[model samples]
Target chain A: MGRVSLAGVSKTYGDPGQTVTALTNVSFELADGEFCAILGHSGCGKTTLLNMVAGFETPSAGIIRVEDQPVSGPGWERTMVFQDYALFPWATVRQNVAFGLEMKKLPADARAAIVDHHLDLVELTGFADRYPDQLSGGMRQRVAIARALAVSPRVLLMDEPFGALDDQTRRYMQEELVRIWRREPKTVMLVTHSIDEAILLADKIVVLSSRPGRIKQVLSVDLERPRDEDSPDYLALKRYLRGLIHAETAA
Target chain B: MSGAAAGTAVPVILPARRANWYRRLKPLVLLAGLVVLWQLVCLLWLPRLDRQIAILLPSPVQLASTAGKLIATGELPHHLADSLRREAVAFALALWAVPLGIAMGWWRGIHQQFYPVVEILRPIPPLAWIPLSILWFGLGDVQNEFIIFLGMVFPILLNTLEGVRQVDRNLIRAARSLGAGEAVLLRRVVLKAALPQIVTGLRVGLGFGWMALVAAELVGANSGLGFLINDARSLLRTDIVVVGMLAIGVAGLTIDFALRGLARWLLPWSQQQGGR
Candidate 1:
């Protein structure tokens, strides 16, 4: 189950007189435990699409469903990792991870165990007591990922989760993310402007047109794990995707 | 080699220790210098100007003796306790502003409804409320507290409102996505995020409340530092008035120092927030 499906989704902002369409008739489906990346230019409403799926925003038209149930609002079943790593500043890493479990009214012992496990999963077990301010950006994002995973959400939404990091940290975190996903698969939808990131992580990459984002192409990534960017096939795919985005941007 | 290492260590450590000691004593040294200058003026300049003016402005020594007598007679302590009690009660009562402010900040309708009323009332100084407070409470601690409350509530309320308004929207969304209900989000995320600003509001509010309390006591009460100052002025005991003034300054400084300590303890993560 746990298939996320969007049918003819459209989102418009502002009043009827001067409406700005953020998304227009976008339709896609994420299969159970599938890793899907929505690649688009900045301000293409990729984040808006992710928010709609995560139930932070509602589409003006069309429906989004997961497991045959219509998505309502933010729920425990879906958790998100933000680019800003929105860990509660007042909370320690452990407490941030336990927040979802606490909301579920889980027993203290169970919550603690889950928190420990997730912290270990993110390789931040040594920093469980530290506040978010004490952490590097990468470490903070790891805590956020741990927090999202501690809930064992059916759907994991990441909004350009590594976009803010330096290049080295970004590459390291991308690998870390893949390793974690391989260990514990979830229906992951990562929105990013980085074509390399999309190719490296996603099973399927859905490219979108510029503002008033529409699904332009949905290409399956048939490459093996640890995708080699220098390989002929990988380079060819990158060139093709870049050409597609360049055409949209130039237009 | 060991002796050379020790010699090098002494040179490195001695300067740092000396610098820290100097830093610690710098303010006190300046304060002492000012006091000496005041005493010198009292001895040489004020008396030469006029004996009557010298009597009106008591020297530090004269003020100290007056203060000693008041303390020995328990008069100073009694007045201090009375003023502190009024301030404490008023501050406690004013704490209701926190929740009310959060409500106003969080909900648009509530903010729109209450903000205008607050703006209209806030501009009227707490001392301005004294005549009405005395009429309502009949010249007592309640009257003094009412005035202090008026002085305190607005700073706290407005600061809390701003704090809540400025909370990171992403934090609220993160909490919601984690299954935090509205109440849970407000209590856990919103309140914690706003605490630094709330502490700042408390500090400013207490200062205003203390000043208002003194003013109210001067007008309508029989005991307190303000009353003592007024009484001394009426009796021409300028030494007692100066001592009372000193007590007010010292007490306000102590309250602010304690609040700074509290803020440091409460927000170890937010070391840079809220200027002294």
Candidate 2:
């Protein structure tokens, strides 16, 4: 029931004369509880695609639906975890997580309970009172994820959620993400430039071409849970994805 | 003696508490040095000058004695109260102007309508409006207050506008995606984000208000620190004038310090990041 379908979605910026095409005829469907990754180069319009789905930006031409209902604007049903971990700097971790619940006008006790639960889910229980600046980058992103999940959104949109972390932290966060997602399954769409990240986390990888982005390929990741990166199958898939992205970028 | 020699071999470590005490006293020490230097100037340079010039530049002791006299007569407090009352009125008025600025900053239509007028008037010093204020409100507290309002309002208005405008776009989007409507977004995200800048504007505006209050009093008001200085100048009481000037400086510093404390208390998160 949490299916997200984007059909012939296109987005253009600026006026017609100086127009920049960001995406072209992008079409895809995210099934209920499916973990999908949108892999692309820097200017591949992957973020634009994510923004459209999140209802932050409207597509110039397209129909986007979630659970057979069209998305007109941003709603709690489609929550986002931003790349920069846009946890409000002015707010404490608990307050940031509680924001959505507060907006929903939940009772004070109920809001607190949900915030506490999500903070626990993100393992930020003890640090809930701390401001975003006081935490490390990885911890801040975990707070951001906790904030997003607090709303109990049907679709969780993550745009390069681990892009800001160091390699070690990034890998660690990927494992944490999978563990969290497995615990509370939802329709997830993660956008990333890292092929290894896409292969490691996503059930299905949708590779996007550069500039006026279009889906170049959709590869199903049939790898087992807690997949070993050192295994031949994982290495083979990583090589294939790397080659695809490299070829598209080189072109 | 062998035990003493062994103890001397170890490195001496400064206690953290003593270091903190030194840090705290540094500013006071520097201030005392400044006073000493001023006294030296009065003794060495002023005494050598003509009597008239010497009278014009009173010694720090002379200034302090004059302040003591003013305080004894309760004249200083009376004049300060009058000036502070005018400042309070001006500040209250400036508070009303902040929302207008926020509206102008937030909405394109409102900004286009009001921002040009603000831009045009912003460059003109508040003192420049003194003549018009006198004509409009007559030589009274109203005239002084009008000038003070002019001085305080712009900084508050401009800073608030900038603060609202500069609210991170991503934060707004995040709020929207979190099911916040426009009203909730403005109240929770935009206003909270802009608070640090707004507090900055308030602190800056308060200093400007004090400046304008003095200027207004100098021109038209019957009482205030500025009037006290002006009256002292006419009476050739350079000491009283110096006292008034010192009062104004100290008062401004106190007010600024209080506002900084208020900002810290109000926005504790900003305090952690050392504010905007």
Candidate 3:
């Protein structure tokens, strides 16, 4: 139910006479229950592409469809985890996780259960009473993820969700996310610049070139679960992806 | 390891506690010194130099006696209650600015329509409206309230506008993606995010409104601290005049203190408001 398809998407900003193109005639498909990473350098419009799917922005020319329905405005069916972990500062962790359920007008009893379940899922069960400011960066992002997943959306969009965390925390969170995905599968599109991250988590990797981004390569990861970074195949794929990105940057 | 760390921490905390104690005492000590100097000048120094000038500046002991008589007679409390009531009604009336400001901040067309009008009116002092207010409401509670409202509404409205405009864009997007509609988003997200700033606006507006209320009462009312001050001045009761002025100062400080406490309670997540 969560398959997403993009057909010839392009985005342009500013007036017609003086315009800046961010994405150019890009197209790709994400199969249901698959984890795909859109890997690119900064300012590469990877985030813009993700935003269009999340319905925060519209493509100037092209179509994006989720579950065979044309993408429209933001809805509960498609949720996102932001890099900044935009949890409401005033709301407690439990309340933040329960936000979507509340929006859906779920009964209090049902909402509480779902909130507890998701907070437990994100391993923030003991921190439900804390405000966003009281938590560390990694804990706040966990709250964001828990908040997004509590709604049980069909498609999950993460825009560099762990980019703000330290290297150790980021690696730890990657494994935690993998563990969660294995237990409860959902369509996920992760946009990031980290190659190891993409290789470790994604079922498919779509690499885009720099500014005015267009898909340069779409490689499927045939590796087994919990792929080792030092493994020969993992190293080889990382090397190959690095070469592709370096060529684009050099050019 | 823990024992040594605690031992080192003890010395640091001792100095910090002493510094905090000094900080708290410094202001009160200075205020006490100033009061003693005022008593000295009025009772011991000024009377020798000029008896008339000494009579004009009442000594602390003289002011205390005047204040005690006013309190026993209930005159001071009556005036205070009237002034506070006028301020309360006008401040409550001015709260309509919050929603209007949200509209202006959220919608470009509304902002374009209302901004110029606000800018034109905002710079005009509340005291400037006293004459017109008296003409319209004819020297009663309504006249005083109108002046206070004029003083309050602009600050509340402008701060609310700034607050709404400065709401983090990502919070709105997150709420939307979580299935919150426009109205829901405004009520649940935007309003909560802007609350600390709104409270700040309320504080500033209350101060302005209190000052405006006193000014309005001076010109066109019969029963307020301002009226009492003016009445005392007419009768050459300098002690009562000083009492009325001190009442106004204490009342203003109390109002601001209460609003700050309310803001802290309402917004526990906001450390910036507490810092102010």
Candidate 4:
């Protein structure tokens, strides 16, 4: 019964003067424990669609629901890890990890246990006392992951969380994320422009079209855990996703 | 090994305890050299020994003796305490001005309502405000505080406004993405992000504030370094004036150093920002 659905969702900006459509009549279903990746070009509404699910933005039309509850606004039941690795710069890693727990108004002793658990989950246990800037790009993203997971939300929303990292770090993080995603299995909706990442991480890949984005296709990967990138099958799928994304970009 | 090469290399492989002091010492030694040359010139230019002291300079020995005696008597402490008291009042006034100014700046409506009045009053110099403040607040701490506040507020207000505006858009997006409600976003994310800038504004504000307080004290205060300098001028005691001037410079340097240390301690992330 734990599934999120969007029916005829649309988003438009501006008043009566000049209206701009970002998303139009978009509909999709994400079942429990599904890892779905939305991929698109820069100006495309991949992020906007992800924001809708994160409750940062509202669909101007149609219904969006998680477990049959209408999407109203951002709530703790859904957690998001942003691209910028937004750990509070003033806060130590442990404090940043503890913030959502604090906001949920959980008592301190219980909150500490939850925070420590996720910190360990992300393998950031020893670096808990360090500030965000002290950690490398990949480490900070792990801290953000720890923070999001600490709240134990219904679903996890990620918006290109590795976008700022170097290519090597980005690849390494994708592997770590797949491992974490399997163990900590929450339904995750990730927005990315990287075809390689989408192929690597997603159980179901939802391809988004260019600006004024609409879903073009959803390809489900029937592959196993830690799918070999060097495998011909994985390479073939990567090439196919890359071609579609490239065709969209060229257009 | 050549004596000079070995001596220089041995001492300078790493910089001195004060890194820039080695560079500054050359100029300082040059300055001392010039003073010696001046004294020698005065010996040639003037008639006698006593006349030479009057025409060119109080010899270093004389100034040192005066400094020694000033320290020995309770006079230095009395004047120092008075100066510190005025400085404390000024800094406090500056602190009050900053938060009020920042609050005004953050809310656009308050900024619009008050900015014009502040701008109109701002151009009138603190020296000019000296007379009016004395008249309105009477002849003591209040006048000094008012003068300092007037001097401090504008910089703090302008810088604070800039800080608020300069907050990274991505950080805000990140906060919102993480399901941060409005109050948490503003209080935790916005304010903390703006803090290094706010500390910078406070430093600049307090520097100007201290100068304003000294000017205000010159108007009616009977104690304080400003008064000490004025009294010395009236009594034709240049040595005391020298003491007062040196006191003010040293105290200002000390306070600024302390403020910088506080900034470093409080905002460790500032070090990373600077490195970038």
Question: What digit string (tens of lDDT, one per residue) describes model 2 on residues A144-167?
Answer: 999898898999999999999999
DockQ of each: 0.74, 0.76, 0.70, 0.33
Provide C-alpha RMSD values for all models, in order. Answer: 3.5, 4.3, 5.2, 5.2
* CA lDDT, candidate 2, residue A35: 97
Task: Please write out the lDDT profile of model 4 over residues A61-98, one tens digit for every residue.
Answer: 98889999998877777888889876788899998888
Candidate 4 residue pairs in backbone clash = none
lDDT of each: 0.93, 0.91, 0.94, 0.80
Tens-digit lDDT track of model 3 for B27-110? 899789999999988878998999888879999999999999999999999999999999999989999999999999999999
TM-score of chain A of each: 0.99, 0.98, 0.99, 0.96
Interface RMSD of each: 0.8, 0.8, 0.6, 2.3
Model 2 spans > 4 angstroms off: B1-23, B27-30, B40-45, B272-276
Ranking by lDDT: 3, 1, 2, 4
**Chain B alone, model 2: TM-score?**
0.88
Worst 10 residues of 4 chain B by lDDT: B52-61
Which has the greatest DockQ? 2
lDDT for predicted candidate 4 compared with the true structure: 0.80
Residue-level lDDT tens digits of model 4 in B1-276: 598787887666556645767776866897899878755655555446566356334444444666677778967668778767766766665666555555664678888898898789878887788887778888887777777777777777777767877787656665665567778877888778877777777778778877886787777687777777788778766667777677778887787788788888878777843332
Q: Model 3, A1-251: lDDT tens per residue?
A: 79999999999999998999999989999999999999999988999999999999999999999988999889888999999998999999999999999999999999999999998898999999999999999999999999999999999999999999999999899999999888879999999999999999999999999778999999999998888888999999999999999999899
Q: Mind giving the per-residue lDDT tens digits that candidate 2 earns over B39-106?
A: 98888887787666888788888788889989999999999999989999999989977788778878
